[model samples]
Target: MTDDAGLLEETAEDLFEDAPCGYLTTRLDGTIVRVNRTFETWTGLRRVELLGRRRFQDLLAPGGRIYHETHYAPLLRMQGSVREIALELVRADGSRLAALVNSTLVTDASGRPRVIKTTVFDATDRRGYEQELLRARRREQEIAQHLQRSLLSGDLPATDGLEVAVAYRPAVAGIEVGGDWYDAFWLDDGESVGFVVGDVVGRGLEAAATMGQLRSALRALASTGLQPGPLLDALDGYARRHGVGQMTTLAYAELRLRTRRLRLACAGHPPPVLVAPGARPELLGEGRSLPLDAHAVRSARAEATLTLPAGAGVLLYTDGLIERRGRSLSDGLDRLLAEVASQDDQAPAALAPAVVHALHDPGHADDVCLLAVRIR
Candidate 1:
């Protein structure tokens, strides 16, 4: 042969033997007929052991063998080819290799199946990366859940002539913990109690962290003896200055037990529902304004106040309680009035959960927070 022709033939043989991927051929019944150098090198098995003594399925893990017969074999027979099927193979030393496999069925001149040709590519690194990503997502969810539980854990104010209760449900999507939260705590020793239900603007751990900060700030601002309207104004300032919880929505209320005076304010949030003695439920909408940090500055927040006749009830909640897709806000408010009207006579301790169970839309794509208080 000429030198150039000899060199070209030698390079072709070398490429077939030392290609990056494993290559092999098996008989129609899957008996090993031929294998390249790369296949023997990959599985740590020699040509002598594989030829006529073993089949391709013998190199698969036990579970992979079943998958090969049930899914892979039939698919190749019917379609003449299969691509990117993932499977595990057992090496000669009992270790395993994660691989992506592709195959084609070869036919002879008689138009009958002659052999199956397959290419195998290693996939261990890719599989490891996917597992690590899933683990990271799980860890973030756990941390958010733990932080939320700790922030919400506490006792409600209980005293003579007053009853207080709160109900909360996380978002239905487990993608992340939500930003909704509720608090009912004492402003003074026993005379007044403060109620708060707030929602941060986003989801996941960042939203939970921002919520913790806002909850703490609101509680601190309320302790300064400010009424609901002024307290909300101060909270708006706090949020703007800290550059945290921008556009957060919330409702704040202070109830005086002895006098039955209820003061409430809102920031782009759902209005509080009031059920007076012998009257239909109504929403206190006079005190609402845009959410925190909506603009640089604006008119001071206005608060709504009314005398809560003895045995009257007030229900405060976040948007998830009444809102639904393709429904008007007024419709949600009207529906909420009906739900509260039904439970006007129930004890405060039972009112929150009952209204939540009745009016809360499980289909809403956000968290739910409700606080119910009754004057005794």
Candidate 2:
């Protein structure tokens, strides 16, 4: 060979031995024919121990060996090449290392496969980063769950002449905790019951914090015996003062058991549904009012009064209950009414679960909060 050709071959040999990735050449039957210095160092095996004596498959961990025999080798043989794939390699001392491997068939001048050329890249750092990302996601979910529990009122308050039950179901499992909340507490007189159901516009910790603030402020105001309309007005004022953006929907109601009367007010929220004894369930119609943060914009006030006869129940719910994607609001309302009408005679507690199940379906796409009050 000419001197220049010899120099070129020497340079190529040096580059292959010091390449960043591990390289190996194996006979078609799997005997290792040649290996780069990087491969020998990475496996803690000297060239003498690896060359001609061991096969490429011998370096793989047990599971990787099985996968190679069952899938990788067959696919490579059919396709003539295999791209980057994750696999575990067993080192000389029996330790395992994660790696990405790429392999291709080497053919002779006769167009027949003679050997397999494989490149291995360490993936331990990439795997560590992936594990870190999963841990961060899990931590975020844990914090969200804690915030959701804190946003909830510990227990349903006992009220005179009323049976109240509340249920909250998140849209997704694990990460399902969200900003929907319900509260039932007695006014100062201790004879009147005031309740509110509301939803924050978003999810996660920020929404949960806003929910907590709104629920606390509303409860504090309701304790002073404000009627439904005035109570919501107070809430709107508080929301504006706090600079809470246009991101809230709420329905507030007060039940006067002495007179079997209910006064309700809504702020850009779905109207409450009332089920009377031996009567169909119907939504209480009230005027439309803007949600809390829309205070700057002139909006109409909403109020309605209904007489709750003995054995009737009033339901306050978040939009998640009757709302479904690709369905009109009217259609959702109709479905809710049908479901309520089909229920058997049951108390508010039992009826609450039935209503939730009725709203339950693969089509439901949001979190739900349901609060029911029955006049005994």
Candidate 3:
């Protein structure tokens, strides 16, 4: 034989035996017929131990073996090839190797089934990368949760003749934190209390930060003796000027403890619910306007005023309380009103949580926030 022919044959053998990926040829029944040196080295098995003594699926983990038999084998037979199926292989030392496999069904001259040729690529690094990404996401969620809880913490305004309570629940089905928040405190007058329930525009850390900013800005604006309508207007200005919370929705109210007078305004938020003594619960639909910073040129926001009878109260909430899949806004509003009316005449503290729980939807995917205030 010529030296050139011998060298060509040797190079081909070397390429098959020492390629980066493991290579194997099996019979139609998956009995190993031939395997390259790379496969033997990867599985910690000798050629003699693998040839005719084991099958490709036999080297897989128990779960991988089941998947191979049920999906991989049938698919390869039907389509004549399978590509990039991830699986785990149990090596001779009982260790597992994450691998991606591709297989081709070779046919005879008449196209009858012959042997199966497969290549296996190591996938440990890829698996590690995916796991690290998941861990990072989890860490971000934790930090956001902590920030949200801290920002939402604090005491609500409570006095002998007045009561305030709040309840907040995050989305149950998603990994990202939402931007729902509630706050209640005394205005500078010390006789009237200011309370609000608001929703910022986004999710995660950015949304939580925006919620904090808007809450602080609203409180500062309210303490300056701004009524509900003008308070929201000024807040709109702040949002537009600072570029923080555009299109945010909220219901702001100020209640005088002595006179039992309440003033309220809603900036594209759900209408507040009114619970009056010896009267049916109803939504306060007046004093509504577009969401904060919704328009380039703002219009005058409206405010409503009414006297609350003894034992009367108001409920302010975010959209998550009355928004649901497959339910119209009117239907949700009716349901919330019904739930509120059905609850026994109770203090704001117990009433807030009870009403929230009654309207709770396990499938809801946004934050729910409600604030209840009552006059004795």
How well does model 1 score by local distance difference test? 0.87
Off by over 4 Å in 3: 1-15, 24-34, 51-96, 102-118
Error of 3 at 120 (Å): 2.2
Better of 2 and 3 by lDDT: 3
* Superposition error at 229 for model 2 (Å): 2.3
lDDT of 3 by residue, 264-302 (tens): 999999999999888998899999999998998888899
lDDT of 2 at 210: 83
**TM-score leader:** 3
lDDT string, candidate 2, 201-315, tens digits = 8877778778888988988988877777877778888888887635699988888778888889988889889889888888987744778877567444667887887888888
Clashing pairs in 3: none
Q: How do all models score by TM-score?
A: 0.82, 0.80, 0.83
Q: Which structure among the candidates has the greatest lDDT? A: 3
What does the lDDT read for residue 154 in candidate 1? Answer: 92
> Which segments of model 2 are wrong by more than 4 Å?
1-10, 24-35, 45-90, 94-119, 123-126, 173-176, 298-300
In the range 1-376, model 1's lDDT, one tens digit per residue, is: 6988977766766887888998888997788888889878888989999999898888999999999999999999999999999888898899998889999999989879889999988899987897799999999989998888888889988877778888888888557989898888989546889988888988888888998998898889888898989998898888888899999999898998888888888899988888777888888887888899898767799898888878888888888988889999899898888877776446777878888888767677788888888888
* Cα lDDT, all candidates: 0.87, 0.83, 0.91
Q: How are the candidates ranked when ordered by TM-score, highest leading?
A: 3, 1, 2
Model 1 residue 186 CA deviation (Å) reads 0.7
Higher-TM-score candidate of 2 and 3: 3
Lowest summed lDDT over 10 consecutive residues: which window, candidate 3? 4-13
